[model samples]
Target: MRRNWAARLRHVTIDGLRAVVLENERLRVTVVPGKGGDVVEFLHKPTDTDFVWLSPQGLRDPRDHLQGAADDVAQFIDHYEGGWQEIFPSGGAPSEYRGARLAQHGEVSGLPWEYDVVVDSEQEVAVRLRVRTRRLPYRLEKTFRLRSGTAALEIEGRATNDADLPLHAMWGQHIVYGAPFLRPGARIRLPEGVQVIPHETAINPPARRVRAGGPWRWPLVPADGGGQSDLSVVQEPGSPSDIVYLTGFDEGWYEILTDVGMRVEWDATLLPYLWMWQELGASTGYPWWGRAYTVGLEPFSSMPTDGLAAAVANGTALVLEPHETKVLRLRAEVLA
Candidate 1:
């Protein structure tokens, strides 16, 4: 138990940022000092279980690791790794170069992401995070600005092609939300897309649209929320592990409304594509058969590599010249 957990656990406070805990029934985030105060845990706890911490834990070994679920966030993108850009050219395979050498998502996001917080004239706290890699010529900067009444994330940087030859890549924001925020009665809101694969296998190549039913809707998982179900939660309630995608984001934004009315609106002008990830009991470690416990609302720059490759082959990958710099902006606000 915390010494004064009640008053202390309201909004996130920076007590030298040693080990601060912030709780709000549905969302509880703790910032711990690790590899430079960059490790934080965003947990969704209900009355049913404890120690069911989430957001993402750390790595077991840098060389060897597992796939998706909670592990996905850590291994794929650590807050510690690179700066300006998240680079993993040859996938998660180990390499020989230092700054250029990295795994899956990149080096910056895979490790503790260090940042400098600016407490400004109005008392708002802002953190600037950067991921850069030598082998890959580009940088990803995600700025998170938080005040008492508002929280905003701004990304306006460059993923420049440093290689003499053009480089292909995809940028994404994988917002993994945990329980009480995700429950049996909770629902996932999105535009419209019929097919989606389990988060476990999404990182792998299927070269297809995944197994699903219907044209506008499908079952999120099988009937019992166990085993595999091409289940679609377009409008109905969804399991914790339900996954969905939206293609009609020509509007470029969507809202994830919970049962209790806690709405998480995603603005994706810069990231037009959104990938919905719902994994119920699946995060319980291995053999994700019937476990439904969490969800991932991922906003990505491009489709899967296969899709991007298809675009290139068919002539549609986003192309930028040396002086061309495109700025992408997305905003999400929790209404009062």
Candidate 2:
């Protein structure tokens, strides 16, 4: 019931200096600029409402907003079914596969950025992609400011780490929405004393005490495969759990509930963990068969897989000595 990705895009192009091509209503949004400014792409066309995607293609996943080659980085665990993306490499840089040592999500999604085309707002269209990570000396600034309004996206960032590894990293803004734009009234709003963690349910493999409490309620307890941990979850618009959650948002500002409030707001104060991933078809453990509709608000400085060794064993995973500079700020708010 949304139906209007900026009046079907009509056509807008700079094509690629850094990239900027919005063509709504069948949706084809590409705003790329290294890790931080990465919305990469999202193509879905059901017959061109005016034009969403039919003139620019290279979508395997990651929204088909395809932003490859700065070095043409590719390695989603060795082809995550072709096109998952790669390029965030830096100092340690060395991963072609196998458990993955460094470059998991550090640097800037496979570095090689510095692109520009500006207008910022009021519909002149925008694109600003800057990157710096010469082996982690640290300096990242990404701005993919696009405007025509709601289908919605906004992100302005900064990160300065003057050399020193104590900078454990994990940040997420991987938004993937498809299947008639995830129809079914679409709902997923966070912050209200958040707490939701659902990854174990193959008859309970090992999820460990259900997120323990803070922002709890997703598959909170009770699942054979009926679905219920949080109440606003909807599937069938795409039938995959289209809304997604993994919350605890406050200073990180998060809210999205499609179907006329037309929303999307994510502001990361150094990312405090937010992941609302959804899956369908056998549900999910992702060994793969496939089902539609997607969601992943993933913003993290730590919180999964030893979370940087549990933030370095309870000291809060951030330590920079020998000539250091640490200043981080992230903001994104677009509402209608």
What's the number of clashes in each of the models?
Answer: 49, 18
**Cα deviation of 56, candidate 2, in Å:** 26
Q: What is the per-residue lDDT of model 2 for residues 1-336, given as tens digits with 9 covering 90 to 100? A: 222434322222333324445543334556544223445444434432111111112323332334342222232322222111222322112332123344444446544467665553335355556677654455655554444533444446555566544454333444434343344445655555555544442112233233221333444222344554443544442243433234455656555445432234555445554545554333444333444334445555444423233334434344545344444444333332
Tally clashing residue pairs in candidate 1: 49
- Predicted model with the maximum TM-score: 1
Query: In model 2, which runs have C-alpha deviations exceeding 4 angstroms?
Result: 1-19, 22-27, 32-41, 46-113, 116-129, 132-165, 176-179, 185-227, 230-274, 277-294, 297-301, 304-336
Query: Scored by CA lDDT, what does every candidate get?
Result: 0.41, 0.41
lDDT of 1 by residue, 63-100 (tens): 33343343433454333221112322222224323244
